[model samples]
Target: MTLFTELRRRKVFRVAAAYAVMAWLLLQVADILLDNFGAPEWVFKSFTVLLVLGFLPAVILAWVFDLTPGGLQRTPDAAPAETGVTADSGMAGREQLTNRVILVGALLIIVVMATERIWFAGRGNALDLPAAAPAAGLAEPDGPPAAADPARSIAVLAFEDLSPEGDQAYFAEGISEELLNLLARSEGFRVAARTSSFKFKGSDADIGEIGQALNVETVLEGSVRKAGDQVRITAQLIEVDSGFHIWSDTYDRRLENIFSVQDEIASAIVRALQLELDVGVETAGRTENVAAYDLYLRGRQLGREPSRAGLLRAIEHFEEALTLDPRFAAAYSGIAEAWVWLEDYGGVPSTEAYPKAEQAARRAIALDPQSAEAHAAMAFVRQRYYNDAVGAARSFERTLELNPNYVTAYNNYGDVLRDMGNLERMIEVHRKAVELDPLSVFMRTRLASKYIDVIRFDAARELLDEVLAEYPDNDYAKEELANLAVAQGRLADAIPEYRLVHFSRPGDPFSAAMIAIVATRLDDRALAGAWIEAARQQGENNRWELLARRPLVERDGDWAAMAELGRVTPGPEGALLRGTAAARAGDWLEARRLLLEALQLDGYDATQPARLSHMRTLTELAWVEQQLGLEDWEDRAAVVEAVVEELRRQGAGSIDENGVSPDYVMARLAAMRGDRAGTLAGLQAVWDARFLSHWFLATDPVLTPWREDPEFIALAEQVRAHAASERAKLAGLEVLP
Candidate 1:
């Protein structure tokens, strides 16, 4: 017999074919599962290696064995002439088995392919929203009626790095971000924020689902391959709902032509979306120096991470870029952004960093006056470091005018408005931010916090719950929920949530301090002490303030420590803390003097009246004036009353129309008037609202008159009972000692 006939007779060919089909299916399933689970590439490689290694054994087994009616048997050694009826019968049965195996394998292959298609057809396995309908107010961008809106929106997903070394991911990311920035600057084009757009990097999500999540009509995705000075970039813009390619291109060019490549990509997108480019609409790239541009891109990529180390690394790259090309406006803006973050994150004092940031930003504007990034950086410095509300507002407005779709400008402007006591306008700006970057966790969280600030608890809760569901481990979301619990008088409920935040982000002293503060309210002294120490040790910028407060909260009479804190701490915030310590020690005159000094500081007066520091200073000043029985007591009271009225008029208060709750302020005001009934009413309101700071309530001298009141005592006990009940609910969760 011929060798081919012999192989077929032995079922080796059928075995190989069946194995090949099964192996392909197995690899496909493995690839999908590994990618979904975020497994390492080696896992798939090993699986493929094992499959290849097993192929020879499988073929050898097939060649050595034969099928019969009863079971497998060795192939007969008999020659062709000597073969009997039994051999012929065995051959027929073997053929039947081969056909059955091939048929079943084919069906399985079809099933696997269908399953993959169905599973990934929508948002893939990452999200579990309904498949049929788009999110509220967002329609599919198929054409016609939906297209009549005329506003073209797009999200630029991070480009895949196709370089041979696989080390060019940052370059690919920078290119995608640059394209996004370019599109955002284009008028009438609404672009998703980088945080939201890049969240889908390496995801197998459908274009339609990504569009729905981001509330956009189109998505741009691409790959970048760099080899020496030559680069190839392939990009495609797809209409999300129809999955139609609106525009597609591949650019093969030298590194120096990178700016042109970006310009071409932006022009293609604008053309595809049918957006009208205004006269003198500037191209995105600001620098032609390839080396400087590369460094700038790296800096921009690193700056996205809002951590101290990340900011410092970004600063290094930005500085290097400037050294290569001193006129690079974007690079200067990058340096300013990193420095601002360094201060914001407490990596450096505001005094040291803000000046440098301001200088860098000014340099950027000097180089390119129309640079929105430079304007945005200047705005952040003015608002956060300088507390210059007017200057910040102007810069922010100018930034928005330069880049209408700049989401960060809207977010920062909302914050500035909030500080200025414009609650309605703050909410309006935040809503706009959400509209622009619908899928951003940071933006959503910011909006939710604003809702909480306005006492719109239900709305805030809905947003927070949605964020937690999408990102179960999000510390910011968890922290906000804890704050909400505190506001609602669920002290026990807030404790574990705060603990989770502290546990997850141990480097964040604020979380640790919050845990300690909440624990004091719950009368969990040991827990309070533990977290207080944790805060003191881990706290960077605000360590002394936290340490000083601990002695007062515990009533440990550690005046020497407070004195030392005053010596070390600088700025108005430190002055406020020292004043607080003096007030705690019954040194009213000293407290008043320190507080007045704080109010006169550059940081204090520049801050808005709505700020916590301003409110605390005013409240303390009022209390001191009442204690001194001065003729100006009424004047101080009038000032406090006017501020409260203004806050109310601005819609800036809480459930009691004064923010968080006005009960504490009302209680203080009533105490100043010796109105026992009014004081009790305010205290009751505070308790009912669940602003349970037991330590503060018990120790505050301003509330001394009500301390002996029977009704007040009863209310305090009720608050304790509520806290205990909430604690009981956390049976299995970790709790502070």
Candidate 2:
């Protein structure tokens, strides 16, 4: 008589239940498949919307129709006839069987859905998984583990700040980071670095998901409640696979005993993991003054924000911490780290910031000789500011030895390897850095750039595209994409990307300068002139301005202007370019002196934007050496032989470690050696690679002897034609506003 009874009699409830289970199952499978296949989010949303819309229709159809023993039939408004008839018994039996089947099917669907969720939770998006470990020697035993070891590998998530005001977040993070550092220093276990672990700070993802994402077996998480001078810290070490607590403890301590509490927590965690602490490894905090430590923690929290005001504020906090306890080595290290970022984020010149960073790093190291942060800071300064690769390498080695979980050290060390021209080693270290911090977009993009350096364009593009999909407006990734375009001779394509970058950062000298350079390559004089002026105004005579101007000078065959640009370019790249121009102007002795100066100032690999390859410098020097009949010509020739063999080993037309087209370098080397067959082979390879730099090809002194050759002239014409085609495309494109 009731509506509910009527619905039940028609089996609408059963149909609804079955439909719900089926819909849920479909959604689960769809989500997993779509995510794995890199489907657009809207596709999944539309699928869900369609399934929801179909639910009511399915129930309505069930209410209206029913399956009898012989065929489909309309459901009766009243209950089935209860009279003593054979048909009634058959109907009851059939109804019971249908109910049982529907119940069992729903259970199975639920089980299947749950299992899929569990499986996919353990394995995240399939496409995002990191590649396999590189060659054996690539990952050092001391670095973060490449694979999870249940007994040792762990991630220390950022601690929750449960203070009344919820303002002790920095204090809580400091405590968690201290535990992470202490665990990292202990032998026989792997600790995920802070960058990866803290990524799940406020995440709703469960333990298993975090573990799989971080590639760890266990996770350490806790909460901190601070009330004035007293603090209550609760810590628990959980087995990520099982979500079981391996060790848990609560500490109630005064502010002065915070260091002791950290040590106690570290000891308990180490004991629970059955690992012994290594002697001589650095312990918890470097200072006993809690006030100073609080300031240091605040400084560190702000330093993570990569902006000028935040970094400057971070420095102030660090300085205040130092004033509280002048002997706090960690605070000094924090200052050094802040200074390292000031050049990029705070717009401080490297000439001004690096010296201050070195001073702070030296002070930190002096106070605490075992300070890994101090060593890493010193290493970065040595690499970037002094161009002392050997010194930088030594410091980075010491840093990793002290704290092998240092992701930044690995990344910078990778750069050092790049500058040292050890392509394999550079790639290996970059892989290690990514292994340690899988969630870091910075690390991923840097590795992509390294792949670009070696002409691994597809791999680089894949990584960049993956990053862009997740972070659509990531300028760093976009910049690397532009770099890839340039490397592949897609100069016209690069201009739009550079325009996007410039739009994002309107006054960025590097992006503006890059736009100018690409515009010059495309022979768009109007675009080139506009961006060049923009770059000079914004660059304030920085290295980017120098690099951007060189292309214009080369386009005009102004060797004097090139030499003048080089005189003020500042780094080894300046000396190298100046030497090349000097050689072009018939001053072989001056060229030799400047070329040797370049060799003394920096390693063989050239920095980007300069577009001065080590091979270019070597070829120029070779010419100069022969022209002057220098005594070191034989040694130079031997070096040239080794370089030539190295280039050949990289495969023809590859981009070498310095981001130079190996084809271009090889062609220059062959021409310098006066081997006509090698020269032709190299030129053909260059043409195959489409390295159509018309100005460089036309005016390159190394290619002067080949100018009269028929094949060389043909290749030159091909380059000019390609350039003209690209120029037309550029002319048609709307200029950037």
| Model 1, position 67: C-alpha lDDT score | 61
Candidate 1: tens digits of C-alpha lDDT, residues 394-417: 999999988888898999898887
CA lDDT, every model vs. true structure: 0.73, 0.75
Q: Poorest 10 consecutive residues of model 1 by lDDT?
A: 126-135
Each prediction's TM-score versus the true structure: 0.71, 0.74
Model 2 regions more than 4 Å off: 1-150, 278-281, 344-347, 503-508, 532-539, 603-614, 631-634, 647-659, 730-737
Poorly placed runs, candidate 1 (over 4 Å): 1-151, 241-244, 271-285, 343-356, 543-570, 581-593, 602-613, 626-631, 646-661, 719-737
Scanning candidate 2 in windows of ten residues, the lowest lDDT window is: 131-140
Candidate 2's error at 202, in angstroms? 1.9
- Residue 70, model 2, lDDT: 66
For model 1, the local distance difference test gives: 0.73
Q: Cα RMSD (Å) per model?
A: 14.7, 16.3
Tell me model 2's lDDT, rounded to 2 decimals: 0.75
Pairs that collide in candidate 2 are none
